[model samples]
Target: MRRLFPVTDQTAAAETTEGAPGGGDREWSLAELAAAYAYPEPEPEPEPEPDHGPGGGGPGVWLRANMVSTLDGAAQHDGRSQPISSAADMRIFGTLRALADVVVVGAETVRQEGYRPARARAEFAAARQAAGQGPVPAIAVVSAGLGLDFSLPLFTSPLVPTLVLTGAAAPADRVAAAERAGARVVVAGDGPGVDPARAVAALATLGHRRLLTEGGPRLLGQFVAAGVLDELCLTVSPLLTAGDAQRIAGGPSVAVPRRFELASLLEEEGFLFSRYRRV
Candidate 1:
């Protein structure tokens, strides 16, 4: 996996970042982002408050989803997002992973994108260790049938063992297969598919509150319908693909429109990276 470090908005405008891995070649700035989403300041004598769960002090869960779309609102061109993405987008993507405790993804995306385990990055090591996080955030794949390849490195060799979130009715043999393949099987839903709320609660029980979901449309749809999504980090690619690619939120039509307030927007290589908080 490639590494990415954020540059400030001011610096991005002035000069491209050196040692940058393509994208805008350092034109994208995340400095203002660093300020907007500032990490919690240290407390001299921290108090052990009650387990408020999700937010740890606020409401239910602190769910955030990250996604990218083209100018025409197409998330994928040929069943993949890479064709519509840029290097700057990848920097934000990696940064998001570094900051989260767990990354929730859908099974289809895992297969299509050839998912891999999240490895520890030297750039974010000190920050993570200081925040009491592991070397790398865990990967949680939401699946109904546990259809993922057991032998894949994503399940077999992860810095943190990959979590398979499934429903009670998933195939018994498949569930056993996943466990045998060195994966942690978590039954979070009661029906054929994983329940979004139950999944979040299950993760919360395991002390994973800094949640980030990289959706593949269907999974995102479930989260939105559950009304548990707290934030959305969207990257708008400059290209336009008029094909029938799915929208950013591709799933069943949500009746109630969930609104989010713009937190910040950064630009580089004609890409617009925007963070929106649920309002």
Candidate 2:
């Protein structure tokens, strides 16, 4: 069997003549076929909308949570979110990040995903520069107890300002540590733990009108229950994992059905991306 499948001396000659007409020595040049084939240039993407700058907007600010899940509704793979997306999904994610004034996330997600809170596209940077603003969007993390690594990219990056919204009574040492790491700490709640609703209000006061939350299920559920969320951008991946994994919302059971008015649906690479507005 090995000898039967062995490479022969005629292999090179066979390859060279494969595309030539009638097995002749002359080959078809690319120039000869150029007129028959046409390739169109891709359309340029539209410019991103201008987000309300710091302290420029009020409670009417638009808030959106962007997340992706498997067909079985699992947001994470083995308790992590990195495996739930493809390159196309990543490009969409970057576009959403670029369009937002602030990107909010949970501290656990920050630690788990190795979060770097900068806008990862040159177009976004150029837009900001054109608007006479900074190069990247602001990074906001919600930490009820201030439990996170100070040296993480979310806190240490000076190019993108980091905002930590926590309770007033959170540990002073942790607050100090985050401040030392160059994070702008905001006291959002009057009680012992951070209230996400109040945090949203505070962010609006700080001028983050177009806020985007990329979350784990717990945080998404909390915002959904609080009725503070305005828009939902959900991407449904093509694969399905039928086991128990964290969902897009996983907290106290909702009593009645909440309705969302469908805005748009886009399909790409066998994935369905849905946009909805709370009704």
Candidate 3:
């Protein structure tokens, strides 16, 4: 893959080899990818303000959403994102997961995508250990109804215990069912629906500061609306699927659209991977 934005001296040198067989378009190793997408180093902690509680912002807490969309603004094709993605996209996806402490995903996405446990990648084992992280990142599912199949491997066999983020008003029986399946239930909102900011804070309280969300539109919309999203890693596909499909985010429109500045952009086989930070 080739980087297209914020060109560094190293990337510039690689660009000089363009047009040769397997030159600039050569696949990147996991190490290179890791360096390209590494999270910012933790900053010094500040004194806690009076009356602050869990979910209150703190140092090292970053929430980034990873999503894919077509050139015509379709987040998914035929109720799934796989059809609209590429090999390089999957590489970046795995890289993002490897770097995160927890992956926050919406319930519908978990079901639709055949969610599985986040496996420990051998490539990142050393890095993760040095960062004081567990063998693998935890999977945190956001749900209001808690309508999930507890029999799935995602709940039954995670390397790290899975988390269910819901509100206080969720059904008691479902909460019990989740716990029975050995999943940890976290209350992140007062009402039945999850409060996006609270969910981030809840994860933060659990020591998952490097957060990544593989959103399924509505969930991403909630995070965007709550103004808690710190960064976005969006993959722009070259193909266009002109169907009535969900955008990268779905929900009530903000009175003002949020502005984001590009942090990095990479390209491979017509796919554009772009990372943006809130401006």
Candidate 4:
């Protein structure tokens, strides 16, 4: 892989593979990947005991969405993203998951993708401990109806307990079912649907400030529309799938499109891994 944007001396050195035939293709080590995608340092709090509640200045939260799209803007091919993904893309995917404190995903995506519990990666184990984080990031599923198969390993056997984010008005029986399955239920909205901002805040309240959302588009669209998304890590697949498909963000168009600035870009094979921060 090669760094393509905001190239630095160190990152530039990563572009070459010594002793290789062509000397340009190489796999990045986990340390290099982590450094390249490390979260911004937390800002200093003004008060001795900072308040993180609404209107109380706090350490702040960073909610980033990771997604993939084809050259023709298809987020998924045939109801799944695997067909358009590459090996390096999966590497970056794992790195993102490793770095996040929690992963927020929509219920449909969880079911369609056959969700599983986040496992503890030995590569990141020590670093996680030093940072005061759990062995593995928690998985939080956002659902309005709570229509999920609680028998899945994601809910029953996650290294860290899984979370179900719903609303106060969600069906009582369904919520009870989730709790009985050993998943922690969190209410993020007053109505049946979750409020994106509240969901972020609720997770933050639980000490998950480094949030990553592998959206199925609809949930990402809600986060984007709510102005709660801080960054985006988008992978551009070289292939094209021209059939009707959803964009990386799918929902009602914003009155005016939000702008994001490119922070970093990496290329492997023909895929472009791009990171953008809200401008």
Per-model TM values vs. the true structure: 0.83, 0.76, 0.94, 0.93
Preferred candidate (TM-score higher): 1 or 2: 1
- Report the error of model 1 at residue 224, Å: 0.7
For candidate 1, write residues 1-279 as lDDT tens digits: 111224455545444546443233444345433344443343343345578533234223478899999999998889999998887678778888888889999999999888899978787788789878898889999999887789999988998989999999999999999999888989898886898999999998887878999989889989998899988888889998897888877677778788888766666767877778788
Candidate 2 lDDT over 110-198, as tens digits, reads 87887886845665566556544456668888888888988977688757679998989989999999999999999988865778788
Native-structure RMSD, model 2: 13.7
TM-score between candidate 3 and the true structure: 0.94
Query: Which ranges in model 2 have alpha carbons more than 4 Å from their true place?
Result: 1-59, 129-133
**Where does candidate 4 clash, by residue pair?**
none
**C-alpha lDDT values of all predictions:** 0.80, 0.72, 0.92, 0.91
Give the top-scoring candidate (lDDT). 3
Sort order, lDDT high to low: 3, 4, 1, 2
lDDT string, candidate 4, 96-188, tens digits: 999999999999999989999998899999989998899999999999999999999999888889999999999999999999999999999
- Residues 97-210 of candidate 3 have per-residue lDDT tens digits of 999999999999999999999988999999999989999999999999999999899999899999999999999999999999999999999999899989998999999999
Off by over 4 Å in 3: 18-23, 47-57
Q: Is candidate 1 or candidate 3 better by lDDT?
A: 3
